[model samples]
Target: MKRALLALTIVATLATPAYAVLPDEIMADPAKEARARDLSRELRCMVCQNQSIDDSEAPLARDLRLLVRERIAAGDTDAQVIDFLVARYGEFVLLKPRLNSHTWLLWFLTPLAFSVGGIALWRQARRRARTSTERDEALSNLTPDEEARINQLIATEPVSEK
Candidate 1:
C-alpha cells in the first residue's frame, strides 16, 4: 500500500507544470504566447542566474517574461526581440551566448586552459623521470672508496635475531 502511494505521488508530481508563468501573464493569442514562451526559455533569469526566465519565480524573471510578451505583442520579430534583450541586458541574458569577438574567451577558454595544463603536466612528468634516471645513474657511479665505506658501515651494524 505504501509503495502504491509513493508511485501515485511521483506520477502526480511529474504531471504538474514547473513554470512560474501565471495565468494572468499568459497572452490571449496562442501564437504570441508560444513565441513568448520560446523566447523566455532562451533568456536567463538575472536573479536565479542558472534558471530560464520561464522557470524562475524571481520578480526580475517575471518582469523579463512580461517584457518578452510585450515585445511579441508589439509585432517584433523573434530575432529583434532577442537582439533588444541582448542590447539591454548584454550577452549575459542569453542562455546560449553567440560566438563573437567579445564572447570568444567564454567559448574557447576552457579547452585552451585544459590544453595548457596537459602540456605542463606532461613536461613535469618528463622532468621527474629524467631527474630519477639521473639520480639512479649518480648512485650507480659511486667511487670504489665510497662503496667500501658503505659496506664497512653495514657490516659494523649490530643485528638482533628474535
Candidate 2:
C-alpha cells in the first residue's frame, strides 16, 4: 500500500501542468531561450485572460510561446518582440499595459472618481449638520405662555413615591 501511494504521488507531480512551454518549443541557444521565456512571462494569455503565456495551458498561449521563441531566434530584441505582439494583438495582450493618451482614463479614473465621491459625501454631511442645527433651534424657540402652561401642568401632577 505504501509503495502504491508513493508511485501515485510521483505520477501526480509529473502530470501537473506546471508550465505551458513544451519541450519542442525550447530554443537551442541558451541566451535566446532565456529571452523567450522572459518575454513569454510578460505576454498575456488571451484565452485565460489573467495568466501569462508562460503559465497558461491554453492553445493560444502555446502559440504565443512559440511566436516569442521564433522572434528571439530571428534576433529580435525583447522590446521589438513585445512591440510586434502589441501591434498585432493590441495592448490587451500585455500583462502590464503602457500608459498613453488613450489609456489615461483607465489609469487615472479610479482616483478621480473616488475624489468626486468623497467631496459629494462631505458636502452632504455638512448640509445635514446645518439642517439638524436649524431643527434644534426651531424646537427650542417656545412661546413664553406655552412655557408657563407646561410649568403649571407639571406642578399639578402628583409625584410618584418610590
lDDT (Cα atoms) of all candidates against the true structure: 0.97, 0.91
TM-score for candidate 1, please give it: 0.73
TM-score for each prediction? 0.73, 0.69
Which residue pairs come into collision in candidate 1? none
Candidate 1: what lDDT?
0.97
Residue by residue across 1-162, what tens digits does model 1's lDDT show? 999999999999999979999999999999999999999999999999999999999999999999999999999999999999999999999999999999999999999999999999999999999999998999799999998998998999999899
Off by over 4 Å in 1: 7-17, 28-31, 142-162
- lDDT for 48 in candidate 1 is 94
Stretch of 10 with least lDDT, candidate 1: 145-154
